[model samples]
Target: MLILAALLASAAPVPVASHERLSVIANGEKVGSVDAVRDHDHVAIHYDVKNNGRGPTMDETIELGADGLPQRWTLDGKATFGGDVHERLVRDGGTARWTDAMGARTAPARGTALYIGQSASPWALGLYARALLKAPGATLPALPGGRLRLDPLGPATIGGVDYRAFAISGIDLSPDLILLDKDDALFAVLDTGGATVREGHEGEVPALAALATRLTAQRYAALQQRFAHRIDAPVRIRNVRVFDPVTGTRGDPVSVVFADGRITGIQPPDAVASPGEASIDGAGGTLMPGLHDMHAHVSLESALLYLAAGVTSVRDMGNDNAFLPDLVRRIAAGEVAGPRITANGFLEGRSPYSARLGIVADSEAAALDAVRWYAARGYGQVKIYNSMNPAWVPAITREAHRLGMTVTGHIPAFTNADAMIAAGYDEVTHVNQLMLGWVLDPKEDTRTPLRLTAMKRTATLDLATPRVQRTIDRMAAAHIAHDPTAVTLELLMGGRDGAANPAVADYIGHLPIGLQRRRRQAIAPIAGPADAAAYDGAMAKVKQVLKLLHDRGIRLLPGTDDQTGLSVHRELQIYAEAGIPVPEVLRLATLAPEQYMGHDQQLGSIARGKLADFILLPGDPTRDLRELHRIAMVVKDGTLYFPSDIYPAFGVTPFAAAPKLTLPKAMPKAAGAGPAHDAMDEF
Candidate 1:
């Protein structure tokens, strides 16, 4: 997530003599700009970015103390999805106070107690790093919560200009990698898929982004080495009940055996263990097919989180074309830990609001070319974005369908879901995209955050209305599916400034402090009690629509556009809360998605002939959907992973303990014999 910079501009601006300009690049495209002005102890930063039709726009002002850390800071602006932002931090004497999404809080400051602003500009990272350099051990107690540590990544040369690189950890699951100039001022912030760099040095962003990704990959690779158990011998999980998706029931205790990445057999719990085999005591738990996130944007961190949440398969709705293919390769080559990905080609029409993920076409012919490009690259589907030309959908869908690729996406600007379905779209991407037609005027653009903000109008909507039923009827008649992303709606519209978000409340405490604070904040602007009630009513309406769709036999996909992996579980929870049976909800999360993507043969269930892709849970999920959260172990392609061993690396408290693993007795070696090709030796 990009930093949500400052809010409103200062009423009385201070003149500055020095200025630095930075460019915000996403997927190799320029999406935004940042201007920093310095005048003595005061620094003003104006940040604005517009990509995928929406980004944060804010102004930040900081008054530095003698130690070069902020003494007074103010930020006000709009968040990425149109949430209101007005954050402030003030340090006076030995006391520090600030107000953010978590409301106001006061903490005693003692000898450089650093304050990490919730909506600070990227420049704040450089400021924090500079101060931490002076702190003992390059670490300091941070405000709100947690500790900040600065680790040098050594030097980098971009465009023949030398700079020092550092990683600031503790605020998030992954550290923030930053490049600082010789003066210790901000120069660039590098990320896996995007970057913010000096204006003239934008040409080096791709290289810098790649380097950031490599650095992060190295860390995850080390984790994979320590946590991924890829043994060479048969592995048996004993005393576990297998959940049958088709039957919607858990069978009697059994011992499941797998070796060399395939399931070899399923036997009784009392079956005798063979030589050269490893055994795991499942402790009478349930062994079910690993869950699937129907909608996702995969990254290395999210990939690991998916496994921790017991999600083995994900259908990536959109991602960086170059980055995604490489990630897939590394995952397959065993360089990192991740879920099986089903990539969808991102197709957008070139406009000011175009999402810079994949092919951006300006003409109908170019759109068709984009489809062929995705087909050649083996993308399973084409995800049309908001800025695409409505007129081009028919041809794009036709081309994608001809290539045996599914067509799914948002309703393009100025068009409704009815039109896209008529144009041969196989599925609609977001629930708002489908429902906005019933509430918005023809001229109101769904290309912007209005797609989310407009849901407030749903409070007054009548599902029985002719226009609403017409769209639902057409989708049923056309056999078109809908990915409601209901959890996203709940997160956007239902969050209050200081209250815990219902979508993620169950496990929010297990996350880092920074993430916990963020989850409690409202994403959609709720001005007053009336507006809050409207949003609440709107969320209720969203659930009602989900129930209607399910009752009408319209295939509903459980997807969270948010890619934390945990959200996918919340997505299924919302489905269950919408009156869908718990068993059916589990089916939607596992078998239905696999069947939708034609991946069921190998991935959707736990069977003797299927790939060894399942998760071990301490409880029966059929009895309670919440049991899905406590994942003891995950076997992906026969490689074992225990969540309890890997979650600490990301600052997450483990939810379940690892099951006991018993290895076969090692054969005594001959006095002069060479090493044997045995399972223990392989490990």
Candidate 2:
């Protein structure tokens, strides 16, 4: 029996011999070959795989072994296989097992297995197959066996791990996945695909790759230097119109002194203090602590725009890439000027698209890993997105709080805002989340169980309703902050009609050409009969939800979910249109966000010891709120930037003369019997 078993195992497979050349064929088609080479303990079969066939070869697998040992194997097209290959293997090993259907086993000197697959997307499959043929065993999840030759691209820190980046051509990988073992073997690859691969190259792959490597390395080094610096510098601003956002009062012109980046004094106009100190004349313009756009995209350009718009601070609710620490460093060191930015690097979920930008945690273990990942990277909070399983929320929140990181995000599809808060969500976005909790039926897609029950009980919730007030009271008691992003909601609701509001029209000229073109194209499809009614109704619902949240006294912070730089100002205007008092609306943009971000003492007001981040407008914005559009100058951390300089950064040509402002005309009276239409009368 033992001899027969041995024969069966031996006949089962044979390892390739040293110096032996072998060809690999699947169904009579030549696919790859191996070049044999010998080392001390083992013989290495270096293989070359190629795919020249018109269609993607299917039901193919490579069986590998050494000497008489049966080595389990896998075939990966791109080094980073998409989908849940690992999980699939764990769940059902037989699904990926290699087997021959026909006959009794006959061992050959080398073994082979059939890979079963049908191309889903032909072009993508062809590319993947071609890559695999070019680099057989290259897709093997193991370290490279030789010293890697990398063109130094730059320095970068990914997921808090610092690395000197080197550009490697002909491979798609993220810098974070590149790894080198101690044996001088390249163990992993970083694929930067899509437009990002060609960002700096002017369309040349090699040149772009080299530039990417160098830029990444430089960025890493700069970040390290920035992190090393302790922020203890004293700052001062003089001759500014100080606005007390909390009190809705404009204080007398003053000179504010700051030490160690904290407000030290707020004095009358003529206070004389230290010599050789930085002083901003404020150009006789309004000065307040930097404005905060609570919801923003923290790109370098966006950061600059935020500053240009007099936004000294921002809270990035979501972002991809594990580069938050570096972004924070750049902003802090003034290396790349912008706001005092706080970021939630990514949300956690279980979808493919979500995995790319969020932490993919299908289990409690994975969820815990995600929390630690953000905490170690210096993220102040975690923003959860849709599709997250409610079961994971409590564990995620517990782990995050243990690490001192707050949790916030959209209430998941099946969960209501109340459940999310009870699960330890520090803040809720979008008033729609709350409204859905009250009126939606559980059986409908929009209804959550919490909402259905509340509605069945005839629960009336407004800023003052007991249920709504209780929720707010609990949040306040817990020191949890809210970011309503009322302006974004308004735009989504009111601006969907064919007619553009004044605020929207003003922004149209300022938008980047590319974005504007895209928007124009996008609107065309929605404007047609088939989609118009649905779009209009959806927008009206959004507005109704916002009014409900406001009537309930829920704390509202100004946030523009659009481009972070210019949209924030537009958001404030939208808030005014939503019936928020102009002064209160301005406060939401200025002091409110600062308080939510826990930087009230150092930001959100123009006082001694506060960071000098403010904008100068031609008129008082609190009076008309529209005055915000008249941006004369922007001061960020004591640095003055003129409108001319800021507009160019936005890819807009600053008009030598501001465009004539004319309100949209109402539909003409029937037969023109009434007074002649006045376009300027709308505002």
Candidate 3:
């Protein structure tokens, strides 16, 4: 991959002031700022950022060569959970190099290489795109060696501001969007939830974000136009190791065949295919059921991301009642790229501290009405939120169960998991939520950030004590499942600054450099020895609580409340750390969720007549859970997508090559590019 942008002398790239700044807002709160300055043949950028309510607090800087590419980049502060960042990239013409957690590395540079670094700032993409994206595939081949392909989607408008846009590919499961103004300056950095570039125009986010969503859909549609293979004949995966999530066993090399979204045949290795059958050479790789992320907040963007990561299915824990149904419908109709969704209704109560998400109810009858509302809308589960009234929970759960929707969510403020279970909660949301009762008082309002900040005190609790064990036993007896989003807990309360966190260390280098720097930012406050000690204690508490829950026969559901594509793999690793066996963990990620959602017979295991929702991996995930990251191909609802073909759009180099497939004669060609897709009609 490109080490960093090469610094070269050139004329002014854009009209500039000596210094310019933009306010950084997160969740509607102004938390920090980004400062940019330009001089003759030189530019510098600085970001003082903090993601609101449990995110990185970081300080970052980037210096551009006269050519407007990175010359030097540096970041320092608390990121991810908390880690000191000391990264620098220096390019002296022919060779560019840098030093990071992976150690020093050097690479040849073109001197005129027109590319951005892993990413110095969200604004940098638009800055570079302005100079590079004059036409399709214009700047890609010249980019060091990352093989990045920037396909300019053409001019588009956000809040009616006419801006040029492009889809950035090469690093993740999905491509991110970059926008430039009419003057060719970055209008904004548009990602899934919001943007950081258009700092002063928060009001435009909803409109820009909506536009971003539509743009991504168009790109994925084009991808489908290019890659999706639907032959009239049967489809077969040959010479592969079939993994049974139910048995945790890798079957002998066999050929699995399916068509019309159902597996129709399983034959011995080397079996001759029926006439006109299409085949994919699996080359002895493992074919396992697609993974399930049970704790997801569904979005149009995350849907594509999850599917690309081999998560063929996700259980959306909570989301916008207005947005999800349409997104889900489009995905089901094969109009969008995403996993099968089992949605959960978000139930919240109006309060001063209540999170502004999902449905809000003020009375018992309103809560019941909310339950009916979700049920009528086809939600299979109802997720109660932190600010919900404990007194109203029993009635809410009763109504939800009566409406055939399972109850799961945060134990309402001031109530324990045991109390929620007694109130008929089928499942508890996060590991911290399950254990918080052991460390908090009745008056502690969990609706605010305190719900997360207080987890450190759990370290002081003895797992064997009645206070903690009673809940475990009650949950086991009641068959109440716990969604232990372990990755999130560690991120919130674990990891020391400057130390390599095992949860992210192995994969950090593979992520986009900007995300790597972002991951290094801190979340929890660690002001001193006492504070640090509490953080340390929280990690132990997580292990103990999870172990006790597992050892005592309490059900533990695997999911990543964070982005699950790669994080889900880390979730399994964390489960293994808690002494859960690898095979069990794999089952927990696959068959377990399918069974819970009542789709086991139609999905999950790679059995006959099952839905063709599975992935081809380079290695066996049953043994090393991290192997899940090396996705080769994903078959969702019988439509095949190659990671090799998908990852680059998001800036990720493919970890493995796609299995060989014989293309059908009917395969479609790339549609026209250029002016046909220009966002500005008048232009």
- Cα lDDT of all candidates, in order? 0.85, 0.49, 0.72
lDDT, candidate 1, 82-176, per-residue tens: 77899998888778999999899999875367898787767778778877776668887888888899998888888888998898998887788
lDDT tens digits by residue: candidate 3, 1-683: 22222312334355355565666543344555667776644566666654323334445566665556666766555443344456567778677787654356677765545444433556666655644554334554333234445677878866766878876664344556877776666667675455665566777766766677788777666655555544445788888999888788999999999988789888898788776567788888999999999898877656766877889888888776656777888787767778888888888887755554577788889889889988997888899988788999998888888888889998888888888898999999898888889989989877656777788777687887888778877888888888989888776665444454556766776665445543554456666679878877887779877877888887788888876377788888888888888888888888988898889998889988888889999788877877988898899878887877766555555677888776434433212211222221110
Name the lDDT of candidate 3: 0.72
Model 1 residue runs over 4 Å out of place are: 1-17, 667-683
Which lDDT tens digits does candidate 2 get at residues 205-265?
Answer: 3332333334644543443232221222333456667778888866777776655445677
Cα lDDT of candidate 1 equals: 0.85
Of candidates 3 and 1, the better by TM-score = 1
TM-scores, in order shown?
Answer: 0.94, 0.57, 0.80
RMSD of each: 5.3, 20.0, 6.6
Q: How far is candidate 2 from the true structure (C-alpha RMSD, Å)?
A: 20.0
Q: 641 in model 2: Cα distance from truth in Å? A: 3.0
Overall local distance difference test of candidate 2: 0.49
Off by over 4 Å in 2: 1-239, 255-267, 270-284, 352-355, 436-481, 490-503, 519-544, 654-683
Indicate which candidate wins on TM-score. Answer: 1
